[model samples]
Target chain A: MPVYSEKVMEHFQNPRNVGEIENADGIGELGNPTCGDIMKIYIKVKDDKIDDIKFKTFGCGAAIATSSMVTELVKGKTLKEAERVSNEVVAEALDGLPPVKMHCSNLAADALHLAVEDYKARKAGKGPIGRVETPEHDENEHDLLEHA
Target chain B: MKIINFDHFAATKMRPEVREAMEPFFMQEYGNPQSIHTLADEPREALNKARLQAAELLNAAANEVIFTGSGSESNNLAIKGTAFARMDKGKHIIVSKIEHFSVLNAVKALAKLGFEVSEIPVDKYGSVDPMDVKNALRKDTILVSITHASNEIGTIQDIKEISKIVHENSGAYMHTDANTSCGFISTDVKELGIDMLSAAPHRFYGPKGTGLFYLKKGIRIMPLIDGGIQEFGRRAGTENVPAVAGAGVACELAKKELKDRTAHLLPIQKDIVSGVLGSLDEVYLNGHPEKRLPNNLNFVVKYIEGESMLMWLNNNGIMVASGSACTSKILKSSHVLSAIGVDPALAQGSLLISLGEDNSLEDAAYFVKELPGVVNKLREMSPLYEEVKKKNKV
Candidate 1:
């Protein structure tokens, strides 16, 4: 069996904040179709502060626990504070992640950053940013012609 | 409630009966099977008896079964041996996209040797279409190798149908890697129309180092290894007597318990499938619903990575595999998942739970009950979840 830290497992078994905010201030969806880890972050901001945070992840357990821990760490923080929450901080919060699973924490952090950024963008009347385009490779004709 | 554990997948708890049966092999009957002395006769008799027992399980003659160091070696022998021996006849081979790396990589090696290979595609459920095999055939195609059941997705292919197709079209030899299917499902080489079949004892509660390959009578394949006259000169090197004996016992036990064990696994599999999928929205099943192995459950949870979930499951004392257990170290998604056209996001989140005979309904219940909470927690910090929600405007 793969070795996991007890704390990571505990958080996974009894996750802190689950489900989505009904009228979330901003929602962030970050998924690299190429890589397969998809994360959706939901946040409720009130008076320029995060009043609620929740998530629904469909990946590995570390990703789930990392996302769960992120919500707890960022709840009640201002949007800027939440943006400052790094993947390092999340990994540290979970004790540590295996080298291969570090990407899961990174995804969690990126999803959080994207969600907060989306909120700020809407608040500034700039609206949400459009879908970010992934880097392109020309060697594969099928891939090039796919999005085109 | 009892505290649950997940380490069972890595190593099974030995049953008292199995342990008792293996006791004499370690000391009292430790003589070499190849030796002719009186002391060696006991071990030799035991070895031959085990061989016959193994053959009986597969419905083949004892001489037809050759022991190998591992399932991988057996697979290598089947593919490489056939390709090299029949090069004068043809150099073309056929396999499904979802085959284990053992089969796929062997084919690749053959390709490097100027042999043409055609990889047949599978549907979303990982079932290979026999007609695709028929269409991909060429007059020069010498072998059609397909796995009896998929290791990643748990889909059982119709080997009989594919074997018939190969025989009718090109008269090519039909082979199957039955490592993942042998004991849990009935295997009759002749009935299935298979000319070659490979199996690993560890997959059926036997020893890890013991494996078998069956080549029907009149079929000639070159030996990949060269040395002594072990295994009728088909394979070389001293036999792994103890492991082979253990494998024979495992096969016998599996045969005796197949009915009860299969029935026991069904509910656990059903619970896991229904519990996790029912609780989570947009989750998709990766393999066939009904045609899956009795003890296997595979799912693609959208937006999350499988590695992360596996780590979390590990933390919770619930051990399971994600994607191909062999390819877990690689950052890339499973080739099996990719072959089935699963979306990359969902594919990364794929989880494979292969239940052993010992796994219980309670284990399945606990896993299902806790899975959604884990998914939700991951999503709470996800930017992708937020974006999708905003786009949906709910």
Candidate 2:
């Protein structure tokens, strides 16, 4: 079921821009530990263009590859154009991801969208829109974590 | 590609001797063991011989051994068969938390039928306490199934002690899933005092489609498959003759070579354990230090997911298995790791390296040499690692 494309493997083996930008204009952190993946996207904005971008991800091959692919996709593009990029586009860029992985780890574009949102919120003098509010850990969720 | 298989638990190459034994049954002696024709005579004799060979490996009588389609099938027969046969007496069952899906899911299905199931938790090293089994036993308990050893973490259970407790405390039939321990360890049914034992021939270099179930004499079990007079009217199906013949040869060879194989693997296991753990930081072994299978090694490497590590190692010509959500069909980390209280996040980074007779010191050393580079490469991209690094600076 997990026959990853050659492009996914290549990007996973040698990810590009894999580091956290210490002082970024906007940041988007998607996913949580319980889901077995976490992505933190950092961006540098210059005149509404995503001038420099980097990412740090804790996930599987698809997550890392998608993260790398999204960064490659939106670099040097204006915020509006970057927002047009979607998970399907990122998945298409890497040839394709496994269907199961596409839902779980192909979240790089959402993270980029969140980063652009965070950029907009900051431009209006609001603090960094905090990380996505993951569900409160419940017994059923714990069981899923333990036995799913 | 010269692939070095560190994933023996997932699949094993068939031994040449076992393959040779199966050759005649495939084409030359291809006849139904139940047929009354002359062509059936050889197949019928071969089937009986295979049963005897399998029984001898477990020190049980040939008549008590029932061959099934696979280890999971054997487990289903043992668990559900016993449960259904004794449901009039009791509908309660007990199983360890770390049992294979075959045992766990079978009991789960029973739960929907108004049966009660108690899951005994394991220790941090994945050992189920005998007292927990004793406590879980009820007046209405019909069966108790526990694993002899975990295929994931490699921890061997105290089956003898647990079996003794189950016998003295309750009238429930005792079953042990010995799929991971059958060929690698001594599984004397009388010595362990177990009523039934389930094992997979594929795990020990036989063909994949055959399973071995040992039912103690005088125990009543309802058949999972209701059909003809095959398996003495117990498990009804056309016998997989070629695989059964191969399984017999594999069992015979396992009994003959157990000691030598253990001796050969011990030093290599020790070398790999020390080599990997000593060279890496924030890496930990997953099973009992001394009470683990000689051929199994499992570890959780921090800050990197397991699939990435597996892919990198495969690229370097080594094949291994992982318990990470990414590798699992259900997209959750292994329940065995969770049973031992491993963090779900850390459980996503499990690496399971299982050795076999074909593995050598060079292969173990090669794995040790190549692992750190892969871990480093993955860690460099992990945000979790960045968090740890930032915390350490303070």
Candidate 3:
């Protein structure tokens, strides 16, 4: 049997929104270097709806296919509607991945959820990550001060 | 469709002549070799001839060769049987990190059986260093198992040097799995100072269900199979007479054609490898350039998955395999790749294309012609490639 469904190969060969959004309102990056799978999901929100969504994935065919399918499934949907998209829904949209590639489906769903959480955090003015704080110049930067 | 098969590491088609040699034993003279009957006499003679042929190929005595069910069974017999028999002397065993799954899993099983298993590390080219084997050896170490050549990267080990260390430095029995190396390289067991050698007949165009297990004279190993006396009471069962006869003929042919086959296979490998590496950027060969087998070509193409590349290759009528045979559908990278310290991401992109008696320069050309477009397609869709480009721009 073929390891992938025809739809999975289709999405893999022609993945949609396959680049980074320069100013994405919400971004989610998840990876496990041990398994060599990494994915980033980006969303542009407008009026509590996902106006635009894209992804960048560095993984197997299943990962790229799921990323493409997840983007197609979530675009123009309300936040609540987008949040309803599960790994099963994404995998089903792609005619189902091999049981071995089910983890790739998890990568798709988790990345989207992380992005949504990032969006919620930004809207609450408590952005959780992606900030580089300016370092204060100190003479004792290389040396530890004596603690009391 | 014309299919170009480069998965010889996985299996090879049985030679027609060898099949013809075996055809009679399947039914006409089919009998248990051990039974004392008219039907049994032909099978017994066939078994003896098969053993002799295998012995001649390895330059060993016919008595030393024991036919087994398959290559993996031979390995299991060599490692586990040896360890179990010699447990009174020691409980420790040493094996190379880049051994085939049979050896690795056998070692793992020994570990659970309370044996101390030390997996010696390999070099960057996936070749086991003799000195590393020496260092891993201890007074209690009973057996040391290493592959003659890697099935993944095809790096031929210096078994003569390593086995010398095993025999001289300690009382350990030295074993090598020569399944992939049998026809591709010289596997004179006596010359290599190897105590035990395992080889599968199908690897050299023989039928499946047959393999060779050679143990040095006077070396005792406990039987993995406990039944009626067969294979000198080492392996016990009704032997598959037809397959065994085929293996004998195949071994004889492999020995006769060893030099010719190597001469024919090397150019085909070099042609494909040079074509792939010349045209592709961010790609590198997987094993030692000079120390590899004649027909093995392994390369890693960065920023894409091997499964994806395999799908595209299959579509183009090219048959090859990735490092990892998917285990339970998880795309785990090969242990051989991990042992060589390849980046996990790049290891996921590994490809192994092993040539056999049938491959040619034309097949290599076809592969080179079709590969670039497939690689390009995958890379264009890869975010890793985009990141690499952006980084290079900076």
Better of 1 and 2 by TM-score: 2
> Going through the candidates in order, what is the number of backbone clashes in each?
36, 0, 1
**Candidate 3 wrong stretches, greater than 4 Å:** A128-148, B324-331
Candidate 1 lDDT score at position A99: 64
- Between candidates 1 and 2, which one is better according to DockQ? 2
Candidate topping lDDT: 2
TM-score of each: 0.79, 0.96, 0.91
User: DockQ for each of the predicted structures, in order?
Assistant: 0.28, 0.47, 0.22
Expressed as tens digits, the lDDT of each residue in B1-394 for candidate 1 is 4434433333444455555656777889888778878878877776787788778889999999999988889899999999989999999999999998899989998899899999999998899999999999999988889999988788999999989988987878999999888888888898899999998777777777778899898888999998988888999887777787877787777777778878988888888888887899968787897898887777877655666666656556777667621125455568898888876556666777788767788888889888887666555545566667788996
- DockQ winner between candidates 1 and 3: 1
What is the CAPRI rating of model 2's predicted complex?
acceptable
- Judged by whole-model lDDT over C-alpha atoms, candidate 3 comes out at 0.84
Alpha carbon lDDT at A135, candidate 2: 39
Ranking by DockQ: 2, 1, 3
Model 2 lDDT tens row, A1-148: 4479999999988899889887899999888776668888999999989999999988888999999999999999999999999999999999988766767788899999998888888989995986784332232333333332
